[model samples]
Target: MKWYALLVVLMVGLGLQAQEEKDIVVKRTLHLMGSTFEISVVAPTEEIGYINIDEAVSEIKRIEALISSWDENSETSKINRNAGIQPVKVSRELFLLIERSKKISEITDGAFDISYASMDNIWKYDGTMDKMPTASDVKASIEKIGHQKIILDPDEQTVFLQKEGMRIGFGAIGKGYAADMAKELLISKGVKGGIVNASGDLTTWGTRETGEKWMVGITNPVEKNKIYSWLPVVESSVATSGNYEKYIVFKGEKYSHIIDPRTGYPTKGVTSVSIFSKRAELCDALATAVFIMGRDSGIHLINQLDGVEVVLVDGDNKIHKSAGIVFDTNQYVEK
Candidate 1:
């Protein structure tokens, strides 16, 4: 054989060998970030897969420790503790997360606010709520709920809550951020394929054991054990926000337990909102924001954004989707 042809053959062999290294899949699930976190990694051997999964899990736990609002020593809690008093210096990692969160709040117009922690659970869904909160109390409940109140100092790497009683919680976007971070860690370590599912806010990279794209399904908001639609998700993130089970009925109006930070009231009109994006954190936040924005407004906002799609289930069980969300009729199931 010619020397050049031999070199080409050797290069192809080496490429195939590298591809063969990650031949098997290993998936592990555990309770983390206040929800079930599943990590799947494909490696040359089962042991390497386990190792990658462990490192990913550790990264997620570290993130949980940093931003957990319930932890008194967490950076987020520290910022809340000193609300209106002083700015609390935080790690650069935490600072960037808060800064991105603030930008999302700005884009969504406060529909997705971390400062929503000030909201009171006056609207319960566990068969206890009977009357609406007084207007004044409702106003007071959201007094400190404002994303603009969160001041971030990049130079100092500090976070400050403008109001004394204001607080921030990652319950809306923490898991997805954790998932994103975990995926990055695993990918950096040479894992050929993996998935980081934080509860239902999940992100996937590469293919499964069968070498096909990841397929995700949206749960039917109107029917149990049925799905509204399924889509192929490849190297992307998807998150859904809804009060399928938790809701209250007042004067023949159904209200979900997802409280709107702007109004300090339960979300209505839209039943469920699912968002697809490249960032898990963004998808998680947008799901909640779109639910609050309702059908038309939510679809409009999603259309304005790039590389994002949404599916909204309205009160009448009608499905509304964004421009890019072209459903495969074969995968679509009706109520």
Candidate 2:
């Protein structure tokens, strides 16, 4: 599971008129899709709020059934099973998701790839490895991993992998996509306000019960207990990728779990990457991509795109932001 870099800070007031039309914020935290999910919604009454949360949970489960590569019966698993032999027909929704993933792969210059699931587990950060894998083995680990090799048939809605061992997984963007879908479902039902936070990759729509925008606290990677800034989010998504939690130190150098599929090596020089975009899926993929791209190049790419912004923390624990991001200078606290 991805580290939780952004925390949803709920701001509720104590003084309120009893007769006023109050929108209650109801929230539930549960384990889903192998990660923690916090679903919140505003409703006219407590009873209705619970109902809406239940509906949102059901919608998330439905999406997991469709996209989870771990389930052997899922469409993604079928595509992986049929790799190199034949094309497997899938739902149009799955096909489109794969299509968008491939586009991101191209945009990031192969830094982000869904086929990274095909990589061999040569380097372990679980305290099992004392030395780095040989260069040849490291290179061979990514032999079957390439998003460019995934072939899609639009008319038939079929996906094929060029290599037999090739596979695809949505570990990076799946939760964000699920969060977006849940938020949209609530919106369609006329729910005015809510937040679907899939372990830090979160989306918000409408206002809080107090009519204020949702506040997302960006945690300091160096000091996890402290927040560096508060971002007001309205009808937008945010995702953060950080390597401070799980990593291995080899020869006094740190290697994180997030690997670069292109080079089959762990990325360096960046501690955390947070991307803000209109869609959670985009933010999710770009968060991982930009982390692998390093600080300067990541900022350069984010500046080129419209409706996108980035805030990154370099290895020295310094904060960097894109052209559009504005944060209070005094709020930044480094190690």
Candidate 3:
């Protein structure tokens, strides 16, 4: 799913009411990478806090310049412009990001693809679609979307798309990548604790200024305002992909905005999927993949990976968690 406008509510448990004498949490919220980002850091003084936050913002902007497809001069745009004609030499950072994206595509069997941009905008969730697209049109929309067609030359630091119109985008993973980069930059600047919340794709390191582990509340997809559970995010990342805010109903059948790249159709059954992992980038990509993978197969895949867990809410409003995730919530349901 292109989560730029997806409604994801991650209730951060920052103790704003009380604080310790020596340390305090400073935060800033702004728009970046076409999404909302909240950057927070532990600092002894407000002056130092804003300075650190500014540094993180600069780092995020730097990443935006490199990865944004909207920017015609970006490496990603350059590669897209050269599709099928020639390989475009890119920086090692972009090359590696694409390489990692392809690896994720392989893992999910194309449930998540950076090449999803090649798809024609046939389905709109903004209540403008009077009817569904024809089957042939839907099928043709995804003809150019295949990560396998993306060629990467490590030694030459280049990327090439085999089809002339083929395109790749980081909409599903860009914010998380930016968050990860911002966190790393903050840590390198001697910040003891912080959080980079790229909308709902968030990562936390160290603890709150109160010296307590960072806690995050998982919002109930059905209830919207209600939180089902709160869990400690100790040095980890969380990403939630939900269809509650953006979806369409046709012929009494609801369709999520998160489409299956393999079929070029909206996913069904699952309403939300939240992933917990060591990196926000992985959590961000896997959340969308798991939502499209559906409940059974998604849970199965998460169980096999060490240090990765899932908490998914189905269309029935029932919550399911992987083996490693233990939380007390009335929404829990077996199977």
Candidate 4:
């Protein structure tokens, strides 16, 4: 009788441990820079332990305060305000982010430019009907959109935009950077095996409780909830950029919200681009750059880089993928 009771207790304990290994989801919403950001983290309930969600939220807000351009007192805003004159010293963190952004600019040959904010908000895509801007207007906008004008002083940890009206915003890279930082923070706090999902930009570490990989659904551009393909992701970051979010129709032509800095016009040929990389920051910036570069150049760029893969959907819904991506064709409806 004593032996049977001990065996029963051991079995119950094992069952509880197994149950705890199931995936746990924690989410929070915070208002930052006039936008509501929804952050979700998924991890095993077991392992080392769980991180304090409140602490994670506070850390995210701290990063937001440092990087948000809408804040007049932010490091980036100060540098923008002092453009064309002297370099304004900034925090080491901001300086490193700027340096990384500049490297991406070089890699994409200005296709992923940070100076794009210099362009005037001439193209309105919010359901307004109007003819396309004139040639002169386009030319004027392109004149101020050169990444070459940005100067960095490593000694002073400063950034200087050569044009007075020039500005640098991290609309493309901020969320991914935030996700990376949050993941690092969580890991440092001894929380292992988790995912930090910032909207569509997602980064995951470790396998699920069943020892299987985390499954990520790549959304179809035409259909919001419908996933065109499901990819197994682990210890990788995925980011997607599509023109379907915001666009304008002018003279029977549709233009995307993502404008090419070089020509000051919407990029053509590609409709959506999804990038898989080890770093969330690179994945984030490259997704935008690849979308702007179109299918051919985008493929060339991803192929040249090691450990980076791409899945591109053209305007006509044709899907193109890099050699590195592995998945089942039957799971997706081929276009």
Candidate 5:
């Protein structure tokens, strides 16, 4: 072969390699964990990107099967069915999750309780809250709600609820947990960059398809359709818990859906709580905790935690951010 001919061939091969290295983002969305889970990946080829995305969706489905309380045959159901009778053996993953949930309950001073599943939905949001219930009835609403009653046996890998009617649910944190696991699975499968956004409980790693950081918009809780601020996530997670649309009005007062497990009363004065953390699980749980804690106490508790930041929307539609919070002003446009 001629020298110039070989040189020309080498240059063409190098150019093709460079083209492959360029960012190509492929995304897919599916309904999982009772929410829309959007998986995005930046890969060299569409085939590779979709392969990893399907893997993530499978992992999420596996998780949902393990922990969904609604599933009559799931381990969670077994545990709930055997409540106050015997400890039901569960997977190590579920055991560890229960431990983490208990820790979160302790950190939030009972503001975050997994036993919230036992609470009766006395405060209806279907415009049926015309009259406030008696104080005693409201107090009785959460009589069975308490996180301290959940006993975890590490040696046996079992979970026990002390009361027969008591139950635990992951409605607040399950989606975020699924998002974190999916992100980890994708990363291990060589997904260079992407996001696992499970209905706003988002966990992101690496850059977007444009080689820029992932930016998330915080919606105005009072004005659900409006985006008031933005946050940039490099290799972290952000979760937003809002009560704008899920609220009830009683006696000329509005109450949010985030009911206090410590008390049966709904959370008042706070519209939404957005949390940023290294794990979506923590962010998801904390967002719920902060909403129940009210504005001042929630801020105080979050300020004490490390690697956690919160943005609160007050009932008046005012935005309040913690000390560690800094809005991404580049995307913020003043109207």
Candidate 6:
């Protein structure tokens, strides 16, 4: 959810004419969940649109207020605070999102569980740990971690955690869901073409005003500010999860921040994972799931699910892609 500042630079080469572009790009940064959100939208400048961007921002805020686990007054926080005591009724949208997360958990065989929030924060990645946790520690931390224990009542739009301390939060899928909802809202408002770049989780509709597709650069996990691949995205969502973003060295071993729900321990051996799909929510959730599932199982899971593609960067810097991903190899040559 952290807003890594996005630098949108328009480069003009020498002798190039500055023809007026018909596209309009607007960016707004807002504070949410202890992080800054960078939202960008692109559309035709001449389109007769009545949709107000402020209203769209407000909608996003409402969704955040409903699902933020850190917010003590939020619905999700209430469910966590009252775990096993009651079934908290939530908005229909939140209820559906929880249902979808559970489905993903089933698909990944608990690799993408939302119940990991119930785990005790024993593994510190902030450079203070001396050694890895014992097997007993791992087991104890995940004692309350299980997706099967989460009960959902569709009719009542309620979620109940069967375990006393069980919890569910959308840290992995919230931004993507927000991006998808925003895109859908804008499309319903008759906005022709734009890209909703929610940090790295991006969803797009229609093409640029120049009739070309919106292009996205996949950053090289090993190299900063260098793109290893480029994807021309049109009406698709892309999301990436990587251990390279945050980690700590413990007893000469580096542990990532992305913890496995089943083990209550961070996953190793994988550097980064990227998923592309029709819905940003799916892409977002799957990217984290695949990162925890590692290379082989992750690739297999993605292949089984239709309309999903993945690009996995291994610890050795080798790239493995899913069957649905179609990219030019020439574009991925290691520099």
Candidate 1: lDDT of 63? 96
Q: Name the weakest run of 10 consecutive residues (lDDT summed) in model 5.
A: 1-10
What would you estimate as the lDDT of candidate 5? 0.79
TM-score attained by model 5 = 0.90
Clashes of each: 0, 0, 0, 0, 0, 0
| Runs off by more than 4 Å, candidate 2 | 4-19, 220-224, 330-335
What are the per-residue Cα lDDT tens digits for candidate 3 across 226-270? Answer: 666778898999998988678888899998888899999999998
Worst 10 residues of 2 by lDDT: 10-19
TM-score: model 4 vs. ground truth: 0.86
For each candidate, what TM-score against the reference?
0.89, 0.94, 0.94, 0.86, 0.90, 0.88
Off by over 4 Å in 3: 1-14, 17-21, 221-224, 330-335
- Runs in model 6 deviating more than 4 A are 1-21, 43-52, 220-225, 331-335
Q: Which residue pairs in model 2 clash with each other?
A: none
What lDDT does model 2 reach? 0.86
TM-score of 3: 0.94
lDDT of each: 0.79, 0.86, 0.87, 0.72, 0.79, 0.75
Where model 4 places Cα greater than 4 Å from the true spot, the runs are 1-23, 29-51, 219-226, 332-335
Candidate 5 Cα outliers beyond 4 Å, as residue runs: 1-20, 220-227, 328-331
Better of 1 and 2 by TM-score: 2
Ranking by lDDT: 3, 2, 5, 1, 6, 4
Which structure is stronger by lDDT: 2 or 3?
A: 3
Model number with the top lDDT: 3
Write one digit per residue (lDDT tens) for candidate 4, span 218-335.
6555654455667777788887787765777767777888888888888878777888898778888998899889999999999999999998888887878898887564654322
lDDT of each residue in 25-92, candidate 5, tens digit only:
77788999777777888788889888989999999999999889999999999999998899999999
